[model samples]
Target: MSASVTSTPVDHAPRVPAAPDTAITAVADMARRARVAGRVLGHAGAEQRNAALCHAATALRDARAELLAANARDVAAFSGAASFRDRLILDEARIEAMARGLEDVAKLPDPLGRVLAEWTRPNGLKIRRVATPVGVIGMIYESRPNVGADAAALCIKSGNAVILRGGSDSINSARVIHAAMQAGLRAAGLPVDAVQIPPDTDRRHVADMLAASGLIDLLIPRGGKSLVERVCREARVPVLSHAEGLCHTYVHAAADLEMARRIVLNAKMRRTGICGATETLLIDNAIAPVLLPGLVEDLATEGCTFRADARARAIVPDLPPATEQDFATEWLDAVMSIAVVDGVDDALAHIVRYGSSHTEAIITEDEAVATRFLNETDSAVVMWNASTQFCDGGEFGFGAEIGIATGRFHARGPVGLEQLTTFRYEVFGNGQVRP
Candidate 1:
């Protein structure tokens, strides 16, 4: 699904400084240079920007050996949970995806200077809403060094400067990739500072970035629950984020058993470590007896644990009881939670209470049920008879995404080049003054 955000509210607050420590000072310096870089990049022209992106894609391909060596160091140094290491590790295909993402962005239509809205006043004045860059954006993420490349490429192509801060585990890999992006910018005769990565990944630098209100026009956090929570809570800059993805897939009574099974399996198990992975499965009570048991047995054999509510347990007899906390948790792993709802209405109520508003899916053959589920659900992306895993930018043909924003205000769903730009009103008049 495409996002509908064409503009955002301007942050009118003044910048305030924290204690003058060396770490924060360095981060602030980077923000200032990014602002300057944004100005230069805004005028770099679409041709120059596309050339830069092409150069970056080639650079990544040429530097494949060096990139892998750095990533190996990152993989060895990771000390977090086993699931987290999955995000840190990079392979040849992942690097290829990164490069292709840059090339894909270059192929997208220029987001800037496009007229989004236009009108004429009775006083012979013509006004048009034109897209403009959002200025300097700070992309803070934990793990997933590929995000560093994607973020930089999107911001650069959309006429905005960017400051990247990857998790410490992938800092070395991030540096190598960030340098390649800078080389591309310089080769295109654009400012190298257009895409800057902090020299250090200290926690203090992240704090500094949160308070960099004036320097950073927008804050996009791409990481786990903790990282996203910290940014949303303390960030002084305007933020576009969702704290976590407690995504769900509801299997309705009218759903075809085969379609329901395939959709649910892929939704939860295709890549459980991602934000789009479905964590909770709600089966319509009328159909639970006919369908839930076999689905559980097959997934159990495939290494997925099922935590179910009392009603579901009564039918299946083997699922571990799901806790209240489990219903609200975003388990970015192979564990799945199951529940039985009375009908489509009950299913929607359960989702409202426990869902993250990130992504939700309904498997149903009834047109009325599918339409209601899609219309009534308050999520960034909603699906019908499709896996929630499809809520991705590359899948939407945007090369790659900055993040899947669940915030309804500035940006929502898959954040791509279009979501990254805001608009300004351009008025044409023959020396007309306000009456």
Candidate 2:
């Protein structure tokens, strides 16, 4: 996706007030505003919401220079791994992608007011289940600045008001992005308070959001495991958890060696910092010697390191030994853990033991084997002959995702427009009395 818009240096900073006396008070105030805005937005027509999304996309493109400048400040201030820096930095292409994402979301069918199901009772009562907005949402995410754009776009299209609280690492970028979103809302004659961010990136603010049970209808924490775990543990509100992405790519015994090599390399090395990137390589022991060496060389060429089990070390002696903890870890970098399994069953067993249930892929040409892998592997997304890196909201064609949920309830995989809504029953009754 791309946007072809030129930008000039200008300050389009939004008109936001200072923080309140306490984080709790600030969250309360923001939530109140969002709740009020949400009621108006929910009743808005789909055309109006789509217009807002388009305007926001244009606003983002118009503010490209300012957005990049803010991101540069964020990138400079960040003190983390190279992979994390990659997640934080935004260039011309990424900015264009963000703009395009919003436009794409605008083009999607509106999620609200759809009759999911309808039925009539014997008493002549008609009832229909209709989709509706999830109301005010609290979005807490980390360094990826594009997350703010994606979340806002999805929320606006789904007719929900959102309050974004990005991590300090990317707060500058988030603020500018938030400004662009507000500009879009204002242009469409929607309430600007419909989308907001906290006054500052303080740790206490997270607590404030987490404790806002009645105000924030739903809380989504999209970041590292610690962040998700903390929110799940303490948040008084309902949470749609985006857990650690300890994804896997398994090379089946019936796999094509060449295809397996390509899939494994892309799954692990294509932006290794992303949650969808494969962190573990499970290969069948029958073809470990023929396929493992080539796969290792391919990833190693791309600066990937490995922690190998003893069985794998026998195939390649120089590889570092892997421990139980290493297999269970989510290494969001150019590092992977390898293990040789007996076959598909052993692979599935290993996954059941250590996997995060986010995404798992099997490389095999045999239809039966692929079917079993796809059916039996317990994950939000299961792939055959594909890269685990394909586990993205944009890749899934939901415009853009707020996050890939690892949990089973509410939503799984990419949390997109439809997933952001709840349902209500609308009934049409006759004037007949109860018999």
For candidate 2, lDDT tens digit of each residue in 1-435?
322222221222233444465543788888887888888788999998898888889888888898899899999889998888999999999999998999999999989999999999888889999999999999999989999999999999999999999999998899888888887877777887789898887788899999998889999999988999999999999999867999999999899999998899999998899999999999999999999999999999999999999999999999999999999999999999999999999999999999999999999989999999999998999999999998988788888999888787899998899999999998889885786
lDDT of 1 by residue, 1-435 (tens): 111111121122223345467555777877877777788888779999998888888878777888899999999988888777888888999999898889999999998899999999999899999999999999999899999999999998899989998889998889888877876776677877788888777788899899998889999999988888999999999998988989999999999999998888888888889999999999999999999988897677667998899999999897899999999999898899999999999999999999889999999999999999999999999999999999999898876899998887888899999999999999999999996
- C-alpha lDDT of residue 301 in model 1: 67
> Candidate 2: misplaced stretches above 4 Å?
1-24
lDDT of 1 at 216: 93
TM agreement with the true structure for every prediction: 0.94, 0.94
Report the poorest 10 consecutive residues by lDDT, candidate 2.
Answer: 2-11
lDDT of 2: 0.90
Q: List the residue pairs that clash in candidate 2.
A: none
